[model samples]
Target: MKVVFHPDFYQVYTSDPAAAKGRMEAVVKVIDPFAGFVTAEMADHNDVAAVHTEAHIDEVRRQRLYPVAMLAAGGAVQAAQIGLAEPCFALVRPPGHHASADASWGFCYFNNMAVAIASLKNRGRIDSAYVLDIDLHYGDGTVNILGDKSYVTVHNVDAMRRDAYLREVADAMDRCEADIIGISAGFDNHMEDWGGVLSTGDYFEIGKMAAGAARRNSGGCFAVLEGGYNHDVLGQNVLALIQGMAA
Candidate 1:
């Protein structure tokens, strides 16, 4: 798979776990050997403004997070574009699922998933999209930005049990019909992580389910990094998803 990434992603911009040192490096170490790396670009100003208020953009700039956040968002666009032809994974940070259009919380600045999906739509690359946010938390920001849109549907897996969660993903994948599928991949739900509900292999299963859906519908599929902490096992979890999707 083509992994959209940049070395600058290794820079830490905040005290949050998502911005901690070595977080990007951790995932890179595991994926680098098996994946091709592509340098990320900055998102267009208009693209950023499309889903975020000017105030939100200025606030990110005020905090010196604008560049990195935009870069991550750009990586998401790159991933989505790459996905149009084949599955891709974006290893980025300042996880963006919690960021709404005008306000952001939970260590996010810009909603990367929203930015990617919207950019794809704006370019007339897809008629409809299916987003499976497998984050430990609900992708309220993604939903807030895209829910009302006629061409996109968002589903966040919320089951507490491992089996139930896998079933939920399977069910969603089975029912989806779209031009593309996006996974807001998060690892915090891993058994060793904060959520402590899912195991590492569960991510692989989720990725496989998304890949199966894309195959069934003849659509594209991609993923972007989201709320995964636990640096010790984060790499394995991410690699699992990439392998499954690429499979």
Candidate 2:
């Protein structure tokens, strides 16, 4: 498994300067122990006109992204590309599953995963994809963008329920014929996490269960760090997730 990350992602947001830096630093420190598993920085930029309306793109560019959001979105697309090429992980920030087709909200300037999927589909590398969104919040952006497209299937897990969510995941994995899997892994779902409802153990189990489903499907898997505010839980859960995926 190859982990794709960009150190500059820490500095992308000027809104919460300190929080952004802290979150980036914490994720880096936690992942540093898994040396040699990380890959060199690659451009994540892709012109995804299909996913967003031109007006929406212009609005996001004028307001949120300006100069940096583009880079962040680019990194996300690059991570997805790597996943399509082979199994990989994208450690990025300013999590983007909330931005809708017409506007950007919830601190998400661009729908990174959507762009990546669009890129892959356009290149003919991905005939279909299953998006497993584990964020505490619903992946409204992804759902809305790919809602009508049968080639894209979204499985959103609400942090409030564990068994039910996992069962749904299992069902989807068993039924779907997607060529690749994209996980919107959010640590905020962890018990001590900001607005989280699941315990540390539950969080680790969630990752393990999801990874297991991905493995069973014989499809490539790629996960991107979304939102996980509890530092301790985030670190521990991420390490556990890596181990689980390896298993």
Candidate 3:
């Protein structure tokens, strides 16, 4: 897979766990041998503005988070665009599922998933899209920005039991019909992570189901980093999903 990433992503931009040292390194260390790297770019001002208010954009700039935020958002766009041809993963920081149009929390400044999906829609590259957020938390920001859009459907897995969770993902994939599928891939739900629910193999199954759905629809699929705190197992979890998607 062509993983969209940048060395600058290694910078600890905030005090949040998402920005802690070694978070990005953990994933890179393991995936480096299995994936090709693609340099991440900064998002266009218009692209950022498409889903965020100017005030919100200014606020990010005021906090000195504008550059990295834009980079992460742009990386998502790059991953989504590349996904049109093949599956791709974006290793980015400062997770964006918590960011809304005019407000943000949970270490997020810009909603990267929304920005990327909107960019694809704006370009008429996709008629409809499905967002399968496997993160531990709900993607309220993604929902806030895109929930009402007729062309987009965002589903955040919320089952508590491992069996139920995997079933939920399988069910969602079975029902999804779209031109592209995006996974708001977050490893925090891993048994070793904060959420302490899913296993590494579960992530692989989720990724495989997503890829199978996209293939069935003759569409594209991609993923972007969101949350996962355990550096010890984060890399292996990421690699599992990547391997499943590629499979």
Candidate 4:
């Protein structure tokens, strides 16, 4: 699989510089170490307007912020575009999905996965998308954007119970008909992850289940790393996720 990454991705941050740097460093270590993966510098900011409203885009620019959230969202859009041509992974940071339509919150300026899905829909390339968000936090932004849209099916898991959450995820996978699967894979859902209540095993199980769904659908699957503060657990879970995808 082709993995897309940019070194400057670490520079875009709206929160503590230290935390953002830590996450970026971890992502780089994992992706850059692997050979044959294509690394592309994100040079275009034009698509920001395609997924985000003018007011929200203006706020991000005026604040002189890192635009990490926007970039993350944009990166997902780029990856999805690549997915149309070939499978790809978007390794970007400043996790989005919390930022709502009318406002930005929870360290997200624009919903990256949402933006990517929207772009695909607008281009008539995708008729349906299944978004599986495994972050410890609910993907409120994605839900808000997809609530009335029949083309998007959102399965958000943000609870402590593993079996129940997995059951919910399985049900959604069984019922939803989608041409592509977008996984908002966040290691924060793991117990060892910062402020997480589920174990690393549970996180792996979730990934496996999601991958199984993707395989069953025979549709392209793209996973974007969202949030996970613990380096050790994050690394392990990410590897497990890729393995699950391969399974």
CA lDDT of every candidate: 0.92, 0.67, 0.94, 0.69
What's the TM for model 4? Answer: 0.86
RMSD of 2: 2.8
> What would the per-residue lDDT of candidate 1 be over residues 1-69, giving only the tens digit for each residue?
899998888887889899899888888888889999989999898888999999999999999999999
Q: Can you give the lDDT of residue 225 in candidate 4?
A: 72
Model 3 score (lDDT): 0.94
Candidate 4: regions farther than 4 A off = 17-19, 31-36, 40-47, 84-87
Best by TM-score: 3
> Candidate 3's residue-wise lDDT over 1-247, tens digit each?
8999999999988888999999899899999999999999999999989999999999999999999999999999999999999999989877899999999998899999999999999999999999999999999999999999999999999998899999999999999999999999999999989889999998888889999999999999999999999999999999999999999
Using TM-score, rank the candidates from best to worst: 3, 1, 4, 2
The number of the candidate with the highest lDDT is: 3
Predicted candidate 2 versus true structure: per-residue lDDT over 1-247, tens digit per residue: 5666666676736665223557766666876777334433433333556677778878866765545556556666776776655556677666678877777676676677787777788888778888888777888988888767889888787636656665666676567567778877776766677654656665456555555656666666667767777665577766665555545
Taking all chains together, each candidate's TM-score versus the true structure is 0.98, 0.85, 0.99, 0.86
Root-mean-square deviation of every model:
0.8, 2.8, 0.5, 2.7
Arrange candidates, best lDDT first.
3, 1, 4, 2
